[model samples]
Target: MNLIAKLLPAIALTAGLSAAQAEGDALHGKQLYAVRCAICHSLDYNGVGPTHKNLIGRRAGSVQGYAYSPALKNSDVVWGEANLKQWLSEPEKFIPGQKMFIAIPDARDRADIVAYLLQAGAQQPSKTP
Candidate 1:
């Protein structure tokens, strides 16, 4: 095979990642979070679920105070982008017996939400009042 053929697959992979990243629009993510996640979660406080702030790099279910399921609390899951996306896609499948019951079937929505979490998580966290 020629050099161009060897490079084609790598180029395509790069483009695919770029496209996925680009799909996560900030405004759309914020809107979707309000509509979809705010019922049980918040950026600052622990509601039905734990706060989403500082979630990207933190271990899953390691947040203090909130009662996590035994399955999640015992497991070791660091919330990188890919795992976070997977958890958003299917909570039970990602971590069996976890309390969260929602699933974002659309990949775009997951991407947007993941983007929003990462962006927001990087900023100063809100006070948990």
Candidate 2:
């Protein structure tokens, strides 16, 4: 009974932390994307970078028409929360020799950006240009 009581608080804390990490604000993410990513990327077409529509779960460097670096094009990473977080934190470090150099240092901001990307990607129509 004493062991259970001691373990219960730790379990509750772990659950709370997980919930907090998962609860990213998509609205904030949208704003952050505009400031940080808009210069190089778009949702509907390939600009300086590839379209971000339907980005999650898509394989890295798989978007058509955007010229990708050899390192990125060859990498077999599937986009997901973990991968996105690492990429956002440090793109060059995540995939060496990739063209993208932008990095989001704040973990919370990175989470928000990923959340926004997921939400925006879902809403936007996929386009190729």
Candidate 3:
């Protein structure tokens, strides 16, 4: 085989790894969600928990049709990066009796999720802008 043929496998492997790392490095939050969250929460629909589509910058307990735990419904906190980070780090600790499960252990992962959520939510609005 030619030199190009000898290098093809290495080239393909490098390209595949780059793409995998790109997807894995980002959406740290999404990975956390899929493992620790998606069982209950979703980006579009409330599973056992609330849908997270526009959770960022949105009012607490204001998803129209979704029923929120009283603790969450009465929560005065607005959904933003800082609050989300704290809340996800320790759901029950953030608000005793919160319906959410245990907080994510990794702070950076939680922040990534929050960033991803904000970005996801911005999709439609940015289109208009």
Candidate 4:
């Protein structure tokens, strides 16, 4: 009984930690994408940055016609939840030789942007400033 009482709190804490990993809201994500990501990226096509369309699961630097830094071009990184989150959190640190100068900074904002990117290709981008 004594050991079980102590273990209960640990179990509760573990459950709380797991519950913190919630999926971002795609709608709010769209708004975040517009304000933060649209300056250089798009769901439709590439401009200063590569398109986010089909980004998930794609190998880094694989978009056709977009010029990429040699480090990115030669990278083995794949765009998935974990790597994408890290990349958004800190670009230069994520890929040392790459030249991205921006970061989303907030974990929620990053999740929202990533959620938006995952779904934006199937819907029109929301207008935002």
Candidate 5:
């Protein structure tokens, strides 16, 4: 192999590794959920807010007992990354008279939280033997 041919394989390998790293460590939103969101939202049980065990890809107002605001309950918006982003940016703006109080100031943080929620939602429960 010529010098360029030998170097090409190395370059491709480096790029592939970088892409995989990005996917693996790209759970930025989890940090936001831990610090900013855990106070209100719980993963398996209802805290001040409802549980988020499977928030993403679920229907709005679908959780069994928690009473959502009329504005939120009436809407047909599906819970996903895009809707979560908007809701995090400004809860009041997204649904007037909603109970959530804080606004997410950073867009990147919101994106990270969304990614974390989705990943967490997808996890299967481990059985204890």
Candidate 6:
């Protein structure tokens, strides 16, 4: 076999994996959210937790009508991908004394959830309180 032939399979596999990782599976993410986060959160309005409608770009603890922990309310954190990943990995560790206790141990799962939130937020119209 030529060198090009030997390299083709490896290159193809690498490309496929990279593409898969680059964009998360939003459908799977929605399912994960339903199972893991729906009880505490909602897309359109505040539930036990704050509304997740426009969570990605919104500042921490800025959701209207929902009471937030002082630690989170005071923290100057913006909800971007990196911050979301860190927060999901360990909420307490990210923001000490915050009310959230759930932690998604798997990095891939966290990524998926964040992707779902991003996609969902984009699909829905913004709600003004």
Model 1: which residue pairs collide?
A: none
| Ten residues in sequence with the least summed lDDT for candidate 6 | 118-127
lDDT string for model 2 (14-110, tens) is 9997886686778889999999999989988999988997887889899988899999999999888789999999899999999887799999999
User: What global local distance difference test value does model 2 have?
Assistant: 0.88
Q: Among these predicted structures, which one has the highest TM-score?
A: 6
* Model 3 residue 87 CA deviation in Å: 0.3
- Per-residue CA lDDT of model 5 for 5-106, tens digit only, reads 989999999999777544433355676678898988888987778888777677776778888877778878888878888998998888787778898887
Model 5 alpha-carbon miss at residue 39, Å: 0.8
What is the C-alpha local distance difference test score of each model?
A: 0.86, 0.88, 0.73, 0.82, 0.77, 0.87
lDDT of 4 at 42: 76
Candidate 6 lDDT at 23 equals 70
Q: Between the candidate structures 1 and 3, which one is better when assessed by TM-score?
A: 1
Off by over 4 Å in 5: 1-26, 123-129
TM-score of each: 0.77, 0.78, 0.68, 0.75, 0.73, 0.83
- Considering summed lDDT, which 10 consecutive residues are worst modelled in model 1? 118-127
The residue pairs that clash in candidate 4, if any, are none
Would you list the clashing residue pairs of candidate 3? 29-113
Displacement of residue 71 (Cα, Å) in model 1 is 0.9
Per-residue lDDT tens digits for candidate 6, residues 7-102, read 999999999988977777677889999999999999889998898887877899998899999999999998887888899999999999899989
Worst 10 residues of 2 by lDDT: 118-127
C-alpha lDDT of residue 78 in model 2: 87
Q: lDDT tens string, model 3, 19-59?
A: 75543334675666678777887777877787877676788
Task: Supply every candidate's count of residue pairs whose N, Cα or C atoms clash at under 3 angstroms.
Answer: 0, 0, 1, 0, 2, 0
Listed per candidate, the RMSD to the true structure in angstroms reads: 6.4, 5.4, 6.6, 7.4, 4.1, 3.1
Model 6: colliding residue pairs = none
